[model samples]
Target: MESRKLQIRDLTLRDGQQSLFATRLKQEEIDKLLPYYENAGFYIMEVWGGAVPDSVMRYLDESPWNRLRTISKAMKGKSLLSALSRGRNLFGYVPYPDSVLEGFYKEAIANGLNVMRIFDALNDIDNVKESIRLINQLGGIADGAVCYTVDPKEEHTDTTVKKGFFGRLFGKKDEIVEPKKIFTDEYFVEKAKQMEDLGAKIITLKDMAGLVNPSRAASIISKLKSTLKVPVDFHTHCTPGYGLASSLMAIIHGVDILDTNIWWFGGGSAAPALELIYVFANKLGIEVEVNMEAVGRIRKELRTVREELHAFDLVKNFPKEFDPLTDTLPAEIDALFDKAIEAAKADNEAELLDACHAIEDYFGFPKPNLLVKEAEVPGGMYSNMVAQLKALQAEDLLDDAMRLIPKVRRDAGLVPLVTPTSQIVGSQAVSVALDRKKGNPDYSNPSNQFISLVKGEYGHTPVAVDPEFRAKITGSPEEKAYDVSKYKKPENPVLPEYGGVKLAANDEEYLLLELLPSVANGFLKRRRAEEWEAANAAKKAEEAAANAAAEAEKADDEPITGEVVTAQILPGTVIEVNVKPGDKVNKGDVLLVYEAMKMENNVEAGHDATVKRVFVKPGDIFAPEAVLVEFE
Candidate 1:
């Protein structure tokens, strides 16, 4: 085993909160944990970036920049603070101009970020170089991440096509396949060298899927440590339970740092718990000193905090009830994970990989999560899809959607599923499933995102995208790679004061508003008008409680006499009418189907009820709270 000391980075505030709470954690919520994190003696704390600003304005109605400032103040230089950046793209999907990059980083660096970890979804070195140069120019530690993805092919000799059943159906092999993504040691070494040459101080192996096996982790980490001069760190989700083993193996193979979180915010799509690794570290004879007592106290407090966040999500949509305090997983589940980490500590790579696979099979809680590797859904998109399906009252469609995802992904040139790509591919899958339900599957045409990708908006795909697909979408053969200087200088986002709200007082606030103007103004306007925000909060609280109670009652199989599918918020087009007057339907039988966002959604009988009337017919479009069927 490598004798080097292990450095641990805590991701509870960023990836952890994002994985478990849908990034709903606001500045105030994050504040309470900073002191403990500082005391816990981590090498770095991931406090800002990665869906934070977007989610802040979109969902939490808070300023992400201010959160960083507050966190920096709370740390008081006790620990290095890091933020995730999307290379040339920054936080937004489309590549911003060089001018925009400079402007954004000026505020970001000044706001107290010590380390900037930049990554591109496609592993395009072109996308990573400018960001590395800028962070170095600013004199901040620029950490470049090699976003990890792998092919399902067992070996180079295994020349099998990836799309299988779906590919043959759509004739998709002409588009793309998985062999190119088969991440070997050479791949990691190459990416790491590119970053190092660009003056990166650190290189992060970003395994967002938590799919890296211990043997693979050891091989890659060993190769990088031998080949590169810079330190290496591993970042992954605990969603599929493979992270702990992979992290342990990486550490044994001379990894400088690992990303983890507290137990409450760890596991189930989050990072591996620091406590679990503390166990592995002790066994491996690697000393990692931390305030265990303080960590325990913080975890206890955050358990309640997490529940409150869970209630917020559960009340609003189809989010499953989460309890950080309860280990509701089967005993075998914990055993499987413990075994994996143990094997890693013992340097038993085969056992560790087996344990990792076993743990992966356990993630979906009563259901097998084998689909994660197959579907390649990022954790963020996974949580979003769960709630979206619930809001549409179409949880039954989830499995169907998951099955259709591979084809949707392959059809889009098999772009690595991360961030913006994940959402784009995920939505397309939903469209495919819904469109197919209407018996007209659209495969030739691609979504706007796929087209934009073909046009080189987000950067290059790792595998060669289908030329025909590109031509069909972009009206061109293939998008030629371009320099960052080619794009026009983009205008600063417009910021306007609303309802006597205060305008930005400084560059930091202006950047926040610029990042998301409407969300910032909405929050700032309400921050000034306490009365308005309070009243709105109260109204939402009532709605949440009522929805919770209705859900609870629905679970008990109550006779739901009135069924309103659309909530009067989103208009729906009646696509299929499954029931008519005097028709008897079972509790789970579909009564009607409506089309929205190009997907078919169903209104089902909550309890077996006789249809008294059908309110809408095929081709009828109606607003929310539209009565689809009346039951007697």
Candidate 2:
């Protein structure tokens, strides 16, 4: 049997709005778009709800429920309706009241919505679980959303600076400040498990801010899929140029669902467009199963609708010769950016902001939200431009800034921002700059400046010390950095006797010998101790063996006592000779030597009697029956 196919969720209405004006998408416009999406074979359409602030929710002329109803009626017999709901919105961020969430979920589900997405900006598990409960109670499938944002603490080490910026701007800095523990692999896994336990049918990774790279997306999604039982999906923005790459990576990692826009509507300056993704996926043999012709038609119709509303003009003021495909960018765009970089070299706020807006306009319209407020602060645009240039590794451009710094600084009456530390910028930033300068951009490699920065802060490698030297060095609060080459094993030394020292069988003594240093010791203290212990052990073993040999020799030399003289002597018996044959002899004296079993037997007097007869000579072989002499 064939495996089940992955699901595709169309986020043209929700996430796509980031690229265009959401307010411009009226009910009638949505009505025209819904049928096309259905015909295009899209399974899930993420409509709206995540952007609803309390103040604006009431003012929403067409509510989320109303939009769902319209799309359901229009796309009958094709596609499920889905809406994104946030834990909170601008007016006051709060997890939607259970009762309110239950009502909204029931209304949408009753109106033909099949899935309700519960998203939190920070991927808060509790809030996601709460929404899941409400959705389940209302008889709708609940999806737990994990949004990707700049984890303030993870990306930037200083919470104080991050909090200050957000606190002054939004008055709710604490809401965004992550906990000190920071997110880890185990943490994400546990959160996924929690969502599954909370009855969420699907777990979606929402790349809200588009910070994920292709490699990161693949690793994260693959890990999540392998670790969790529920279905996994990926939602990403086109920021930083990873749009299509991230999607492909997600597919490679076994993601069960993916979110994409109809065209380039959801992409940023560097992001890959949906059209390109389809083209690439086709070439790579991934069966997306999307209708390209239908998508193209929708794109054209959407563009027509946007043009009629004059939405492009409202948000952006383009030059007379501006052409989105070719000539839209100002000739001065690069120059103005260079000038601001030079001015930033001198730390000139006014000059930098001026150049920033010019560059910003050249790129798009009302300026990116990230740059808008930052432009007002000193060194803001300059710092940002430096970061970008550093990221790009445009060395010639960097060289230009470096050369222009003194001149710009002298004119602006300010000290240059460049310092000794800047010289050590990482290779990643330099590499990016080099690539950009060459006009062949590769996002896979990071700028050199970034590498240097991280290395400078964290120190470079794992360190280990010789066990003997461990006592000499003091414990450090920081991580010990060691050269990798120092870790190779040394050759064992040859010892005298036993060919080589045979490792013996005692625990404490063996451990002490093993601890002996392999290299030259400054004081040879441990070496001396080990040598002494080995010698002592050997000496003791040798003495014990020698003593046992001496005892055996003594036992062999001892004399045998009297035994009965019989005609038949038994083997292993000590026989005694009593008498000898002579003219006259005294009694009770040794007479002859009797031998048996290849050993000479000691002969002695058997009784107090005179020797009557002599029996055998010393050279004669004897059996157990042989007798030497007899006494009476």
| Each prediction's TM-score versus the true structure | 0.69, 0.46
Residues 453-488 of candidate 2 have per-residue lDDT tens digits of: 222221221122233322222222232322323333
The residue pairs in collision within model 1 are 239-269, 568-624, 568-625
Residue-by-residue lDDT tens digits, candidate 1, 268-317:
66677776676567656777656677777778678667777975442222
Error of 2 at 512 (Å): 78
Q: Give the TM-score of candidate 1.
A: 0.69
Worst lDDT run of 10 residues, candidate 2, spans 412-421
Off by over 4 Å in 2: 1-6, 52-60, 88-92, 150-181, 269-272, 312-632
Per-prediction count of colliding residue pairs?
A: 3, 20
All candidates: CA RMSD in angstroms? 21.5, 33.5
lDDT of 2 at 312: 37
Best by lDDT: 1
Q: Candidate 2's C-alpha lDDT?
A: 0.50
